[model samples]
Target: MFSIKSLHKIIFAISFTALFVVWQWYFVKSVFNFDFLARPILADGFCKDCNVILISLDNLRAKSLLCYGYEKNTAPNLCSFAGKSYLFKNVYTPSSKTQDSHFSIFTGLYPISHGMTVPFTSVLDSNIKTLPQILASNGYTTLFSGPKNDPHLPLDRGFERGFSYKDKGDEPRYWMDNMKKNNLLNRKFFAFLHTYRVHEPYIPQKENINKFYPGGPLIYVTRNDLCKKAYIKLLSQYPDRFKNLKVLNDDYCNIYRDYNTKYAATWNVEIESYLARLDPYWDAFNNLDFLVKKEYTHALYATSIYEMDLELKKFFNELENNKLLDKTIVVITADHGEEFFEHGGHSHAANLYNESIQVPLIIYIPKSKSQIVEKLASSVDIMPTILSILGIEAPEKITGIDLFSSKENKFVLAQHVTANLETIITLKWKLILNGDEKELFDLTSDPEEQIDLSIKNTNISNDLENKLNNYLFRLPKYNSIKSEPFPTWIDEEQRKKLIETGYF
Candidate 1:
């Protein structure tokens, strides 16, 4: 028993076992355990009979809403609703792309966990249970209404798993009329309404436009002609920069033509749409005045938001008329925010900047006190939060916490895998990591993220980078499901719709 060699082997074995145990604990805590200050109180069956409605406004930015401190009153109805709802001041999406972020919202998992980080390419893992599936299992009628041909949310692509009813269009009135006709309004239900009306090609009605932009109507023909003229002028002025500009059908006028002329009559064309189609020729806009472009785009976008607000007001009024308002819990949010050249990008799926990741989150719980919550939240938190309010238990492995609970997350993470960008954000500090590049911003002092303090704040930057790296590395080990390739069944017509919606 006192032999030296035998004693040495025992000590070695014990040391190895201890190290393995420690490593195992760290891996589990980092990957599966969502750090919370305390256990969330499960109010089981508290809202068992309440109806849940989740409205996702495609590409709607928080700053575009009046309640979020936008200069213009772009969404008056939503603002009024916010007065009686819980408005989250800082809610960030896990990804800037529509498909990825929506997947996170439905599964209560981040892009890395759910494996839908790529836009129009990555299919959600089959093993991940969606919120709709859980709600439907709990005796709730699940409904979905959105663009029928939306390539980002194809019914066959796991999105139609639990939906008992689905609409081919994104119109609220159409959805409501159908619900009433089907006698679904009286049941305990979970309805998800999504729309791209306020997205790119912002074409608000003439009346709605006049309310925001007092400058008469923005004639499409005139704007189209002007853009063509500007491009021509730029080609002649900056031959070197415009040498590779491609003209369609040998006519510059046809350069910005819709992909499908047959659908042009129904297609809402706008100056923004034309400009977006000029990708690869984005430099052609250099000849135009920057301030003019910004102002014009902002005005059009504002009008679109206002138009949606009016639609929402009508929808809410109908719910009240049907005596369903008091029994309904409404959750209003956006897939992600749109970027208007904030970081040299026109639309989303390009970067993880604040404009692309920050969105408004409003929850209207019947009889709950209305107040502005200053806590930081994420898109992944939506599923768990909704389930908690409905008194349903969330999946044990999810990364989201009940937003209403006293538990708080140390940080929220956002990533745009297509762009190879990732960010870890706290209430004050935000660290963006791209390959070896790093950017740290003090959100409290520089909410716009104008300055880079990574070099000056090395300590903070290093700490965040380490944490982010640890989390990312631990994910693959725990995630059993792998992302699948884009389905081949998506037809050419659907591809056209996706392009028209700026998802190309």
Candidate 2:
């Protein structure tokens, strides 16, 4: 006989044991199934010809889009023009930051394999075969225009041409100069433009800022940018040696407690930045809608997509005025999305929550018609889909499936790395494997990712964990050994900038 508490404990112990056994059994079975990560033979690869213009909006959230059920009409140009585009309900990037996510986007490989898993890490391994590199070989005159952070320059990511992307206005101009010169060639090849409109500082002009921040879901974006500017300005004055900050966000909380102290003054100047005025509410969900109306929303990105949109609209009007809308495959996507206190986070990189990882994938299908698909796609698949669309054989080394061909989840994989280790996400669930602990979430039931389903669904979670661990193990090792140093995605120029700014 047992007391009530003891009886419950005994039952729990038995349940735990049973779950462990079931998980072990399923873990082996799933890992052995090679069809999960299959190489797709796309028939579309052999039957298409169109001008491809791939544009990625940085840090733009899917839920923010009007097409995806949000209340606001954020992307009117896209919603109205694109006919056969598939807006994948769940498309997650491997990592949340620009460096690793875009590296994965370009290579169809995981961050772990490419060694771009951490921030400020230098250029991706030059030898790694990338999407643009493969596309260039297939007669595409690959041209890209965006912010300096686009590819970190140098190796140029194999694209034939690269532009100097900056945070100042004129994002539209970045591509126009090239567009006018290559307008003829563009009719024959693909031109890519990636924009970063939603990265921090949501930096728009005073008039522009009022439209989104004076009562909205984007208030956080504007306020956060204001704080960052203030902080960065103060950090700029520090010695390079002390400025090398290891912590992702600031860690000097207690230092400013006593504001009257000399030490506090230094930090106060950093923290207490002043602007003319702040908007009513900066986090409005209708921020993009307001932007679309004003036309400066694209300029707020520091690179020009609105201008690009105007150019595109003008080009299309002229084309339809002459007849060429059917000949272009226009796509709009995001590397990752900005976090406006969604998970008590600021930038992408620290964690892999849905708001930060979920990106919009809309392609205004060329000549044909675009329709939204209810399938879950990964950013990795975008490159292969592009290759297939243009009738090109995807390179042998790539691991993405042609999404248009395979509408099912044979298991879409996503990974991310912070200071310690990496995490992996799948369709059914997400398994985060840090050194000593494992976090599991059943994404279907819990989209917010609030519950740790690992213990509750040990059998399924453990199986997912094994696959994630094994997948990470396959990434390229820097040293000849199994483990080496932590990842640093910053380039030499960026490193110098960091050093000068006292950010190690």
Highest TM-score: which candidate? 1
Alpha-carbon lDDT of model 2: 0.55
Task: Put down candidate 2 lDDT per residue, 1-504, tens digits, no spaces.
Answer: 789999999999999999998897678557854333455333474336666767776777776666766565555665566544556667777666666667677777766666655333344565676665665566555566654322232233332223222222225445545554655344455666655445544554444433333432233334544444434544554435235443245433322222214443122232233211112123333445543423333234322223234444554455455344567666677777655444553445356667777888886664454566766678887877877777777766666677767345545555555434455666767877667777888878987778887788889877877776676566454311213242333346544433221112
Backbone clashes in each candidate structure, one number apiece? 0, 38
lDDT of 2 at 450: 82
Predicted candidate 1 versus true structure: per-residue lDDT over 118-163, tens digit per residue: 4445555667889999999999998888876554675656677788
TM-score per candidate: 0.77, 0.66
Query: Where is the poorest 10-residue window by lDDT in model 2?
Result: 272-281
- lDDT per prediction? 0.75, 0.55
